[model samples]
Target: MTTAQKRSDVPHAALIQMTSGIDPQRNLATIEEALGEAAAQGAAMAFLPEMSVLLDRDRERSSHHISLESGEAWLRAMQDFARRHGIWLHTGSKPLLASDGRRRLNRSHVIAADGSLRAHYDKIHMFDVDLPTGEKWVESAAFLGGEQICVVDTPLGRLGLSICFDVRFPELYRRLVEEGAELLAVPAAFTVPTGEAHWHILLRARAIETGCHILATAQEGQHEDGRATYGHSIAINPWGSILMEIEGGESDEKDYRLALVPIDPVATKKARTAIPLSRSRAARNITL
Candidate 1:
């Protein structure tokens, strides 16, 4: 594993909230504008929302229209921006066509300021659900699930990687904490119904359980394709407190915004000093 440069004790990070559409070019433009704003606001690291490149509910269109190569433009732009601004860029999940033509993977990337790829994580859990509101998702039909849990060494600290639905599984977050992760990134384009119901609870639970800061960049409002997403993008501390959240917004507002949240390693250490819950779990006895 490549060692990440140690940054200062207090690091500032920003989460970029956006509602993407079917047009990849337009999405790239929006991401560029958001990153620029984040850099100007003195964010040491910036995160983008899930489906950052494109968001189409139609399985056929999503599978056939988007390609991994299509994301090259956005990746290059973000790399240059990160290098120029001297900040880390966490580009949220982009649809990548797997070697097997049958499925695509929702992949998230962490890029260093020197324009090197630090790590990439394919989303392990797929959002396959049937909702009562006539809204349904069959992510398994279009996307393949990732097998390995990913954790990356970062300038600020070790970061655990996860996408939207993966947040529902507490075990994954626990595994990441065991591997020395101090922060967790949950980039999501959550549906209106589910986001409203469980988003805050799940995020806070993961943060408290792992004793890590949670940075969740999300899609808020309605997309051009007429899909409504829950748009309260937030950053939560290890103690399960919300540091910042974007509250009121219309369904289609394209706001390029950034929030600087302070992350303290000492605070995380202090929170875990008592019982060492994560370690105790590893040593627990189980009956077969």
Candidate 2:
């Protein structure tokens, strides 16, 4: 049996929904407060939204804060923080120097309870589009796309990591499921338009498709950089049921919400066994 099938622990995961500003220090403080609260509330793990460290659209101003040196320092600090709390931390995503060191990469880090780096995934799909609201995002112009799929074992079971725009692609989740992901994390900073239009449907579809719990922490409301995000941070079960949801609003420091939801590996097993989509697809030699 796979690791996911053998596990039966249901750990409570804390999802921190924030309206991160341009200040990395301020963002870090917010995360620290939320993590402290989550730990006090008995959460085994905590998740942050994309750009949790810094959310600046202006590359010129953001460049100073997003260096490889600064990113590493932030990771080290967070590692120590997680060690203190004794809770696993999935830092949604942060802006860091790419492998080439010329452009940036949207990277997610998974830190274990013991303060060890377990796995990290760079966002492979870049958001480059023009919407009806006249908002155009050209992520590729500044950030290099990653070329990997990352899944790792944790106390919560096998976790698949993806960021923001990666949710639009179904194949990634399929691959993650095939690799034995019992839970999927899609940390995002989604614009209001797309988040209203597609966020819940897309997440529910992925959960139902993969038979894995979906944990999506998101940036909400208007940011300091002038961009607005749709903030409805949510957790869905393998059966496509909404486990917990925190709605969005005006950016307020006091309004940052932490939602605690139990993640059960048994639910993943039950859903997959009942539907048997994975087995059916494999039996039919499905490929794309």
Candidate 3:
């Protein structure tokens, strides 16, 4: 008789970058094409950027069209694609209206190779900021905050989920690591100013501190609504090293791109062993 496989044997993963528009169909097609390319490049798992289906800059328009029932189309498409390609897929944040009629949740979904929904994470932190460069975002004004942090077990390893602005909080990553997360996902639609200043440093710090691989998929270039986003989607190792970075240039505008990255739990352990910061922190916290 054949034996059942263990959970720790999954393969390499990929992250997809999307410059989404107000049209859901266009966004779906763009992501589908990117997934096919990533699969061809030997990715066993892939992740999409936040707001992967639509980037409606207008608040009222987003609120008007965002529906949980109607949003099933995107999820169904992702599930079907994962099943057909035999890979795990992570759909980045979507705005789902709550039953209260007062707030919407920014949520993400993970699908297994068999087309099953493995887990879902509602972004706990809302992007409420007024940048020094005269740009402003008040996400809390339109969206409700999530109360729980979500971590999921995958074939590759345990993954802790967070969205754009959540990356700024170190406590969340520490808690996730305490929960035994070996991989972290930070899907974002970061603005050019902040991303240029803090993106790489913050992501690298999270990877180094938590001793986990970080899969960060980001939106690139200016949107149809005249809002600009920083690109350069990246995958980082536990030791704060960059594995693969999807580069964006001044005039380049292709956002439907995919980068295949290999993540090994064994390698992560070795990297952590070299420094042992997480261990040292634990030791220091102990009272004599």
Candidate 4:
């Protein structure tokens, strides 16, 4: 416990970039190591990349490993790990087996230092797209969309939670701001091609548009299942300035890294007042 905790109620949060594989056990081990290092470095909170629990190539086989959020052993281990470290843990995204057992839910969960569940967010937007490179994804086939937006308060600030693909839609984030979000968290397993094109722009834009600090955890490198992800975990201030980025090459598909930054509430307020994008839009009238 560092009294750095009382500094304007903002604390150091670490963003982890990982490359998860089909084996949940191995992924869990890797996460434990990474989190241990983060805790040792004096981080009060840590953000894990989306699907950091597991990534598989076979869509049907993945269902076997996906577990419901409440009763999953792996998720429990994650919670215990957080409590042991005395640090807030943001489990980016995991596959929660739906009650119907026909599909899964791409969900994110927040764990307090005491290991209690603070909030959980299911990803509303599905990544369904076809690329010219002959790659395609119909995410809706494997996972159902989430209906609600999630925001929660902690030592850091009020956080707006979202998974990958949700970042592309600005409306959801605007709604989050209206709900008093001071930070935006994006956990993603983004494809390399799309990451190269849209990763930085989409994240920075979200921070600027809402005047909130952004913590985006990511997966990088080619996985055992043959999926290649873009890995550049980043932190940005309310002013949309890049506070810190993990040391990684654009093609560092197998490299794991971390980015840590301090969040300041006053900076968010200042940026909101200076830009006022939301206020300006609210005052305008549109005719179609």
Candidate 5:
């Protein structure tokens, strides 16, 4: 058991970058390994990249594995892993059986250090676009978008949950910050082209605009489905500074990529005081 009862004065978030495959079990192995390492290092929480547990472009065959009914192994394993390690886990995103029962949704789950389910956010913005690289994504066809913006309270800080495509929308971040979110989680399986063009810049912009610490974990390298994902998982401070990032290429299992970020509430306060964007919102009526 790697659960640490003592809290560090300053929390360190472990941002994990993984190149996930088709097998959910294999991906969970990597996640458990990363959790052990993170707990050993005294990390306050661990944020995994999007599709960290499973990435299968094929909806039909993938459903057999990705679909989670009550009492599923993958979700149970994840919760138990977090509990045994005594660490908070921000799952990047996974396909889970929705309330409708017939469909699934891309959901980000927050498991507390005590191994209880704290909160969950469904991906609000869908990836429905045709990229310049000739790769097309119709996320809407497979999963439904979430209508609510979710912010949850935690020991480290208030957390705002969002998926890959949501990073493009500044309004979401602003709304989250307005709701007292000091930290933003962006777990993505971004395409290589879009990620190269806008990933870092967009993440920094969100952090600067919202006055929050942003952790964008991501899927890197090509997957079993032949789709290449942009993998440059990073952590940004409230002042829009890249504190740390992944250092190696895709599929390098020899070197586990984890960036340690200080969760600074003082920096968030200072940034908000300096900018005062919330006080100066163009639309005073928009709700999160």
Candidate 6:
């Protein structure tokens, strides 16, 4: 593990909300610009939205863009970019061909300031759903579900990684908290209906129950692939308070949006000590 350069007792983190398109080059440019800006604002780490590199739903079109993580030039460039900027980066999630050579995976990469991969977590839950708005997503059909949970140390804290659909499963967050995760990352590209109805509620519930800071960088606006996503990327504190948030919706104002939130380890400790949810769980041995 690379030693995290602690800049301050309380570090600030950047949350990037993007309108990523099908072209990987264009998306890379957008993220590069955001990373520079985040570094300029004195952020120690930047968290990007899911599918930061490519967002096309068309299997044939997106298949060509998906490559092995080791051979993916775009990912390497981003790592170099992180090293150059002297900041850590959590690449919300990227689509990559699985090592098995048959299926794809929605994977999140955590790159240290030295450009070394600290950890990578493939999204365990697939967003296979049929929305009320006549939209359907069969993520399991295209991507293989991951089996392991990833929790890693960073400049901010021990981060528990999860993707969009995984947010709905509270058991995952509980297990993450049990593993001593101080922060949880739930990068997503959620549909409008689901986002409006359940996004904030679910995020707050997770934070409150686990007593961990929640950072949900998101993909917003309409994409080149004809899909629209709910925006409003947000950061929630351990007490379920909204620390920072960006606007939601399609706009011609900018290609992306950014916000920096302070991550206070003191708050995490206080919340956990006050509630003691873990102890309560230990007091009971009931299974559902």
Q: TM-scores across all candidates?
A: 0.90, 0.94, 0.91, 0.92, 0.92, 0.95
lDDT of each: 0.81, 0.88, 0.83, 0.85, 0.84, 0.90
* Local distance difference test, candidate 5: 0.84
Ten-residue segment with the worst summed lDDT in candidate 6?
A: 1-10
Tell me the tens digit of each residue's lDDT in model 1 across 7-97.
Answer: 3457778777887888877888887777777677666788988998888877676665556645556677668878877778999888878
Clashes of each: 2, 0, 0, 2, 1, 0
Please give, for residues 44-152, the per-residue lDDT of candidate 3 as tens digits: 7889999988788787877666776355577888889888877888898877777687678888999998899998988988888889999989988888888888889
Model 4's number of clashes is 2
Model 4 vs truth, CA RMSD: 3.7
lDDT per residue for candidate 6 within 52-130, as digits (tens), equals 9899998998888888887888889889989999999999999999999878999999999999999999999999999
Q: Is candidate 2 or candidate 4 better by lDDT?
A: 2
Q: Number of the top candidate by TM-score?
A: 6
lDDT of 2 by residue, 19-124 (tens): 8988888888888888888888778889999999899999899878877745467888888889988899999999999768789989999999899999999999
Worst 10 residues of 2 by lDDT: 1-10
The order by descending lDDT is 6, 2, 4, 5, 3, 1
Taking all chains together, the TM-score of candidate 2 against the true structure is: 0.94
| Pairwise TM-score winner, candidates 2 and 6 | 6
Candidate 1's C-alpha lDDT? 0.81
User: What TM-score does candidate 3 get on C-alpha atoms?
Assistant: 0.91
Error of 6 at 53 (Å): 0.5
Model 4, C-alpha of 152: deviation from truth (Å): 0.4
Say what the RMSD of model 3 is: 5.6
lDDT at residue 135 of model 6 (Cα atoms): 88
- Give the Cα RMSD of candidate 1: 4.8
lDDT of 5 by residue, 90-207 (tens): 9898888777766678988899988999888999999999988798899888888899999998767999999999999998887898798999999999898998899999999999
